[model samples]
Target: MNDFLLYEKTGGVVILTMNRPEQRNALSSVEICEEFEDRCRSIERDPSVNALIITGAGPVFCAGGDIKKMRDRSGFAPAKTVIDTRDSYRNSIHRIPKALYNLEVPTIAAVNGAAIGAGLDLACMCDMRISATHAVFAESFIKLGIVPGDGGAWFLPRIVGYSMACEMALTGVQIDAEEARRIGLVSRVVDGAALMEQALELARRIDAMPGRTLRLTKRLLRDSGQLSLDHHLEMAGAFQTISHETEDHREALAAVFEKRAPSFSNR
Candidate 1:
């Protein structure tokens, strides 16, 4: 929308780029929060946009919050200020994790470089992730003498297990792309220059899929987190019912029977 953030729709993909290259594309200032949310909401509202890819300009993805701003705000230390800051982080830039959780379309994070603190949290929100081999992830909040305020605490443990999350949070250690792939933090990693190439390639392949199934499957996965195995199996049956009834499913079945490639309408 503005220089701070930009969105471009191409085919079934919506690319949301963080535009603060001078600041490593960090979402530090409060000015762009509303704009950021509005753009993301627009993406959600578009049924034609089947996937969302978040990345930054320049080399680095983000370096987390503005340290100078944090230090300046620390002098007050009132409970209300602390609460408001936390809320601001969530409502503004850090809510991607939560919003992506409920998004009807799949989301991906193309990590071009360092993703520290809130940047890492943003990655964890994506349905899948691709990163440059030169990219790194850092649980850097502890280095600033604080805990993971947004979705980092929840996402890290689920992604890499509790022990790893604890170690990463407490020590603020940075994990390279290989380690991230090993620990399941990322789906794929490639050369720095090839990061977006890989992400776009993958996005294109997935965008050609049955859109309604992907959306419902994403919703089911999110719901499975809170349900028991038996209950989830029951839920799976319910989800499948919806999936099989889509017009896309009918087309796919007919195509298979006719020995032709399925032309999906994503109905």
Candidate 2:
């Protein structure tokens, strides 16, 4: 609800914009993390929302943690004690990944500019990523003499593989949009002006699908990474059974036979 995070819904696509342009939309305070968790809860409760797009408001997508706050020994950095630092990460920034990973809706990250440290991990949390040509990314925690405390270790390797993730995390070097695409960090890169346009177009395509099926598919994919082949197939079968019983499934089949566009209720 705060101005730091802006939420807008169009049809089944929801846009969540980080609005702190002045600080380059840094995750500088507890408020930003809390607002993000609250918004995820709202999105989960809203049955009408089938897809989400996350982006930043200004030139930089996110500068990651607030360097200024770190310098002052305030905010999420430089806790008074080691235990306090651990608690800070657990209670604050960790909530974003927990909420987003469990979110049923399809999510996209439109990286408009710089995505450093935790910002890079944030994009990795989404189902897909599209970047502006001017956008840059870095696993920059090493440069600050800290490890990735915000799930970058978990998210980065899955997207860019172990070697690349290790290189990025160890070196803390920046990669441009084209390099990001080459390494499979981003699916595509476009002009800065076209960033949102491309992201919304992708969101609209996903929004046109049945909401229940979309959620189920995302769940299956998430589980697939952890489950054995046999177990995954069994899970897929169970979900398929449920999918077949949905009214939207029947409508889709009927439309196919009738040679017409399917009218999905998103049931």
Candidate 3:
């Protein structure tokens, strides 16, 4: 892990902390994006890690892009042409969402404070979101005279519906944690001091499940949005067949009959 990103694991849950409190954990530098992608890949290969929780180091969850870098064009790159700028986004910032979207394990965004612009989209990339009472969210790209260049356009609508997503994106207004929860953007809200505890508690519940089952279930959910009902049912059938053959499945069945907890080895 780099200085800007901190990685720690306890049992089946891995916590990823954006460590740049000074910058409000802004996803501005190429290094931050690269490190994020690398960590996603690492987690994908680790079966022992059944869940992930993303949070920031300080009060601010993330402030999105670095304004100074955008003005100076130093954080991205020196791009003289439109094509250069386009490629910079494709090869740099875009990688974070692509990598995250493909990650096999379940992920939770523990929004500690401000999640603005691309930062809010970053939280949306996760499978679930839980916010602190002090946290705020916004699809704030319009405020900067830009659009959702970092997949916010694609993600926000799915979480908060088309009308609400449009309202936020078009107006670039900030919403409190309670509003976020009410709109279904975040699943729950907790006291600022209990944010991580709440997130970790949820992570542990998810992590206790069979690892392969969790991955397959997540994949099914991801594809369900795009798949027809017939196709989705077929895919689910195939996955269910494969899952039934796993030792973890047998253990789960045995535990049910024995009235005991299942000990899953992630098999």
Candidate 4:
């Protein structure tokens, strides 16, 4: 709905492109945050959407927060008082991670260029990341004399491990795509020209599965990180029961025996 972000849905795969090349796709304001949150909600409600790929429109993925807005005390920057600033963060930027974390479908970040500060955290929030050869990343909040107030501490450590997260955060150093892949920050790195094609190819492969099953699988994977093995087993059993009863499951089995392509109703 907004020019800052472009939403394109093809069959069951959704691609959200941060469309502010002039501003380097900055996470500039609360309005932009709301746009992301709203689109996430829309994807969750749409049964046909099996996967999501987020990328930037132009050269840079995102520049993090807007320095101009920060200096002027506008957008999601400091407010008139300490209490208001805290409330602002909770009300504005925090919505992104919450919305993304709770989304049912699988999500991927296609890092075409630089992803810094909040931008890096945004990529970390996704289920997977694919980076271009020229991509750059930095947990640069410390460089700005601040910390990641938008849940970077939690997500970054989960993606890149505690020690590496500390190195990135404390040092505010940038890493290239190859280094990101070496540290497992990104799953794959391709040429910048082929980034979207590869990302969409992966997404389409994911979309070929039964929709309900895909969502359930993603839910189990996300929950397993925070859950005890025993608890996860119980939850997995419940999810399996749901999957077992679906029409798609029957079709999948029938196709295997018949040696034919399965057509799913996504039930």
Candidate 5:
């Protein structure tokens, strides 16, 4: 829907490409933030969307915030005071994580290159991450004398444990794809040329599931982190009750007994 972000659909899978190659797909402006929020809402409303893959347009995944804009205190909603700055972040850049978090579809971050500062946090926002061999990542906001005002602190620690998150946040050191994989930041790392192919393949595999149940499963997994065992089991039981009543669930069982591939209506 916007120039900075490209939306493409192949069957039930959607791909969102950060299309600002000239700017290294930096999360620099309010427009990019709006684009991400809008597209995510659209995807959520569309029942046909079962999976999402997010990646950058060019060699760089995302350079984080625009340093020039930051230096001048001019991007997103430019503010002249502390209160105004807080409001600006809440109104602008913060929308991406909130939107992505609320999105029902399973999400994947296909990291093609550098993911620095807020960029690294953006990848952490997704359910799964796959990286290209040439990709590098860092919690580099400390290097700029700015903390992650976009909720990176919350996400980074959740994705990579507290101690590793502390090291990355405090030192602002960059790590390669293999290091990311070893640290459980990315599940897989492949050649740069095959990144999208690998991501799409993974997305398509997930897309083959029954749609309603897939969304419910994702919601359960996400909410489980904040829930006690008893509360999570109660919620899971309620969701499973709904799943069992769907036509797709019946078809799945029938297919297993018949020894045939199941075709989900995604009900």
Candidate 6:
């Protein structure tokens, strides 16, 4: 059977693609959500992979949750069907971002085209985003008479500031890659065909860096966002103490003093 989400391995990076191009790759079918989440979970099975890139096949990223499919139900209440779809989308995450959130690695979203509704929320899951110049983001839920589900409201405010987040949320605006970059929605915007190339280059650069420290830093940053300064310092200090004892840390410090590149084996 063809995979709804395609998985590819590149060095320390895992690339995941939404494989349904026929419907602009929308997660409208219930089966697609299950399949997509399965692929995401499978990618996390590899220990050597340190980062991930999520994109979609075809010219469009995802057309939100499959609005057409959900609405086509013969007699189901429209609102109830939407709520069901929202639940499915929430469950489809496979606890992956929470893993990515704590995975001591990074994730990048190479938004190649329009990222709508749940699609836009999916992009927000990553730690970084690099999109095609023509990519668009739509917070389209309000137009459908439903609220943004799947963490869009949560991630947008965190990354772009409350004021900007308020504007995006209230307007349900479709932002272009340039505007996305301007308001911090994405980190970089490249030509359509070059999005993945640039993302891998970035993943390679990140993968080449120290893995242990990156993990520790990820934890530190997560804590910093919620913990008080003293609490965060205490957390970082604990991590630093544990980190300094690692052989990789010793090698990195020694290499820094000796004026040579540090060879890290994640020891």
Error of 6 at 169 (Å): 1.9
lDDT of 3 by residue, 100-187 (tens): 8999899999999999998999999999999999899999989888889989899899999999999999999999999999999999
lDDT score at residue 66, model 6, on the 0-100 scale: 69
**Which candidate number would show the highest lDDT if scored against the true structure?**
4
lDDT of 1 by residue, 24-76 (tens): 77657555655656666787777787888889888888777767667776321
lDDT, candidate 5, 1-267, per-residue tens: 567888899999999999888988899988888999999999999999999999999899998999889878798547588889888898899999999999999999999999999899999999999999999999998898889888899888888999999999999999999999999999999999999999999999999999999999999999988999999999999999999999999999999999999999987
User: Residue 168: error of model 3 in Å?
Assistant: 0.2
- Ranking according to lDDT, highest score first: 4, 5, 3, 2, 1, 6
* Model 2: pairs clashing at backbone N, Cα or C within 3 Å: none
Off by over 4 Å in 6: 29-45, 73-102
- Model 6's alpha-carbon lDDT is 0.76
List, residue by residue over 1-267, the lDDT tens digit for candidate 2.
567888899999999999999989999877788898999999998888999999999899988998888888898856589889888888889999998999999999999999999999999999999999999999999999999999999989989999999999999999999999999999999999989999999999998889999999999998788899999999999999999999999999999999998988977
Clashing pairs in 3: none
lDDT of 4 by residue, 237-256 (tens): 99999999999999999999
Query: What's model 2's lDDT at 178?
Result: 97
Clashes of 2: 0
What 10-residue stretch in candidate 4 is worst by lDDT?
A: 71-80
Estimate the TM-score of every prediction.
0.92, 0.98, 0.98, 0.98, 0.98, 0.86
Backbone N/Cα/C clashes per model: 0, 0, 0, 0, 0, 2
The TM-score obtained by model 2 is: 0.98
Question: For model 5, how big is the CA root-mean-square deviation?
Answer: 0.9
Report lDDT (CA) for all predictions: 0.81, 0.92, 0.93, 0.94, 0.93, 0.76
Residue 159 CA error for candidate 4 (Å)?
A: 1.1
